[model samples]
Each structure stands twice: as structure tokens, then as C-alpha cells.
Target: MDTMRERFASVTSRLLDEDPRLAVVLADIGVDGFAAAARRHPDRVVNVGIREQLLIGVGGGLALTGLRPIMHTFASFLVERPFEQVKLDFGHQGVGGVLVSAGASYDWPSGGFTHMAPGDVALLDTLDDWTVHVPGHPDEAEALLRHAAAAGDDRVYVRLSVQTNSAPRAVDGARFSRLREGRRGVVVAVGPLLDNVLAATEGMDVTVLYATTVRPFDGAALRAATGLADAADVVLVEPYLAGTSTRFANDALADRPHRVLGLGVGRRELRRYGQLDEHLAAHGLDPRGLRERIAGFLTSAARA
Candidate 1:
């Protein structure tokens, strides 16, 4: 069971061999993993020596030449640090490329808050038409990565995390998979939080929806699950910033009278450089914390 980042390096190495149009740009972040790939395709695999902005600029330049570029880095450096480059290089320039990231929200707690990026997705939401994939398992990550690499002129962002579920679900790179059905409410679990969400909602009469590709946000599936009921109650459990997808959910059920509770990393930064599990628990993302919040939200909604 290799981590998603390991799988990314291996799978992407093979992709470089398979697709001549594919190019990978790195900022010295995953250089060791991609060392062999660089040797094999020196012309295509590029390392920008810790320059995050240049990493994105190079990808955009490659995309301008009609090559599908895959940019790799930690989440904070990839999205937050070079956000202006991301906005202008790809979005404003109107080109397509795949941005693959590691070091999710609190993946490396010892790296400290500087490495964490719980607001990455929310930040990207400001842009338009970007395909975002948050894979919960390595297999899903590979599948989504392949899809993004071959997307051919469409802007895609694939967020890779250290956290993963016990198993992988079949991901089509789009649409929400309904894992459990209930009439009381719907709990939408986004990447890596499925196992905890499943545990939290155990035996509860609430629909559980698993989301791997969240940007295009399968609003249709959400509508179908809740049946657009007047008293619909929805809970979104994401690994990134809390309420990141609340607006999307609201737009999805705009016509209906419904309630949505967004759950994920809070605004307050935890200064303690604790373990990953400790971070999850502190943010109320562990099974115990999630159960309390989810149950309370549903119970209160029932009374309403």
C-alpha cells in the first residue's frame, strides 16, 4: 500500500513513456521520486530548483506549445505560493495542464504550518472551469491523474493527500458515488474522509455520497440523493477548509428549501506540530468528532 505520492511518481513515470505530448515540471519537491523519469525523458521531465512560480510558468509555457504539462509540488507551494502564476499562466492564458500536488493540509505536521494548505481548494474556487480531483486512495489518484494528463487543453488540478481510506472506490473522474442511501439527510464525504465519515454515520439514516472530483461538483447526484426535498439536510465533510463546497451545494439546491452544514479544517491554526491523526482529531474530522457533529446537525434539522 504505497502512498498516493509514491504511486504518482511511478504512474507518471510510465505516462511520460506512453505519451510524447506529456511533460512534467517540478520545483525540486519530488525530485528524488522522479529521478529515474528525468533520466528517461530529460527533455520532458524538468526541475526548476525550488522555484514554485517558475514551476507553474514553465508548465504554462509548455502548454502554449501544445504539450500537456503536469506540474508537481507541495500544496502550499503549488497553489498558494504561485497562485498568481496559476491564475495568469493557465487561466488567463487559456491553456490546459494538470497540476498535481502532495503535502495535503496537514500531511507533514512536522513541516509546520508553512507546509499546510487547507484553503487551497477554496482559493481555486475563485477561478473558473478548473477541474479539481481529490482522490482518497492511490488507485483513484492514478485513475484521475491519467484522466487529467490526457485532458487535452482543459485546466485540471489533482490534489494528492497522505490521508486515504481503507479501500478504494470506483472513480470515474467525475460524478458523486452514492455509497449509502437515507431519507433523513445526506453526508457528502470528500477524499480520504470516507472511512471516518462512514464510521461516524454508522447505522444512521443518512445518505452517504463519496466525491473524488469535487470541482464540477456532482450537484445532480446531490439533488437526486436528497430528492430536492423541502426539508433536505446535507452535511459536507471535506479534508480541506470547511465550507469550501457549501456554495456549490447551495447552488445545486437553490430552488429547494434545504440546509447544508460544511465540515472540515477550521480557520484557527493549530500551532502544535503534532501527528497527522492528532491534527484530524483536533479539527473534528476523526470518527468520534464527526459522529458528534453529524448526529447533532441531523437531530437539530429533524426538529426544525
Candidate 2:
């Protein structure tokens, strides 16, 4: 499968060539992927080695100067480390830019917790007027990147995860697209967790909703799906922090009382690190773990 980072570099290169307004700022991560783009558009592709704060500040400056800047780096550094820069440089300045981050929650487990950022989305939620896109596949990443670049002064954040699905699906809007129909409940899968979510709910009687753009939480589509399916149980499976979207879901379903199970990376730090699979299993994000959790939740809901 084509990785999301590669697709980001390729699409960004095209954006640089075609749109003079688009610029990319890098922080020594995935710089090689954009080497050719940097060489061609030297002035547009700016690389500030190891300085996450400067990286975002430069992007904000570029945006202020009537140019669309795209910032790239690991999630940990991109959001968590330079949070003040994000809040002040971009948010305070009222300059919109696209901040694209690679490496999902625990994509680099060998690098330990310092390299992992499960609270990125939650942190972004603190700010206003920012659009977040979590694409499940490379194709979706390319599409979202292009859309965000052309959005005209919209502050967008595109999170690219290392894990991907087998193939790409159409993502034209922020609404949830129904993948499977069931009567028991609805399981909304976010980003790269789609395949695992499918496996976990394979034999279960539940409606599966896929979401690539999670931030603007498509309450209308979710409400319509749940209303049509008459499901009061909702299980939001995200790739980031657990219960990250629980509040949004609650607001979406405020018209009716419902049960929700939010699943994702846990808050506790797992000091032990080896492979990505190990970290995923430890967090109950693997296929088997997800299946067990989903089944237990639904079974308990049934009894209730």
C-alpha cells in the first residue's frame, strides 16, 4: 500500500508546481520526500531543522504574507511541542494554514512516548475555526491535502497515519458514510481504524459508519443514519485518544439518550516499546483486542 507521507509529498509537489500560493514548511521530518519539490520551488519549500516552534511560526508568517503554508512533522512535535506557537502564531495572528502531521498515536513505538502524541486532536479542539482531516488511505490523504490547499484561508490540519486500509474510498464531504447496516447499534470508525473496525464488527448486528474528516463531526449524517437504523448505541473508534470525540457525539445525539463507547489510545504512558504491533496490542487497538472490547460493550448494552 502507498503510504500517506509519500502521497502527501507527491501531492504537495504538484501543489507547489501548479499553485504559486501554496508553500510548505518542514522540520527535518519527511524532508527527503519533498526534496524534488524543494529543489524546484526553492523559495516555497522551507526546511527548519529540528525547530518545531520556528517551523510553525514560519508557516504562520507565510500565511500572513498572502501565501498558503503547509507545515509538516511528527504529531508529537507538530502539535504538542509547539502548541504555543500554534495558538499564538496561527490562531492569534488570524492567519490560516495547513498543518499536516505524520506518525499516528504510536506509529513510532520504538522511539517511546516522546514521539507519540495521542492528544493532538483533543488539543486542537481547544482552538476555534480549525478543520481536521484524518484520512484512512493514501488516496484519501492526497484528496484531502488538495482540498485543504484550495480551501482559501481555512485553517486545516491533515493527520497522516502510518497504518492504512487495503484500498481508498471516496471522501467528498465531512459526513459519515455508512459501510454496513445492522439493527443493534452503530460503530463509527475514524481514519485507518476502518479495516480493524470491520473485522471487529464482522458478525455483529450493528451499523458501521466511516469518517475521514472527524473534527467537524458530521452530526447530521450520524443522526440521520442512527435515526433511520433506529440505533441508540454508538461506539466511536478513533485512532487518537480514547473518548476524544465522545463529547461531540453526545452533542450530536442530545435529542435522544444513547450509550457510547469511545475507544483509542489510553492516557497512561506505556514505557515499554518494541514494534508498532506491540504498542497497538498494549492499547487494545489491535484486531483481536478491538473485537473483544466491541463484543463486550454490545453484549452489555443488550442486557441493559
The digit string of per-residue lDDT tens for model 1 on 140-250 reads 999999999888799999999989999999999889999998878999999999999999999998899999999899999999999833357999999999999999999
Candidate 2: give the clashing pairs: none
- Residue 121 of model 1: what lDDT? 95
Q: What's the lDDT for all of these models?
A: 0.94, 0.90
Per-residue lDDT tens digits for candidate 2, residues 190-261, read: 999899899988888888999999979998877876775555788899999999999998999998978889
Clashing residue pairs in candidate 1 (N, C-alpha, C atoms within 3 angstroms)? none
Model 1 Cα shift for residue 203 (angstroms): 1.0
In model 1, the runs with Cα more than 4 Å from the true position are: 228-230
* Each candidate's clash count: 0, 0
TM-score of each: 0.98, 0.97
**RMSD to native for every prediction?**
1.0, 1.1
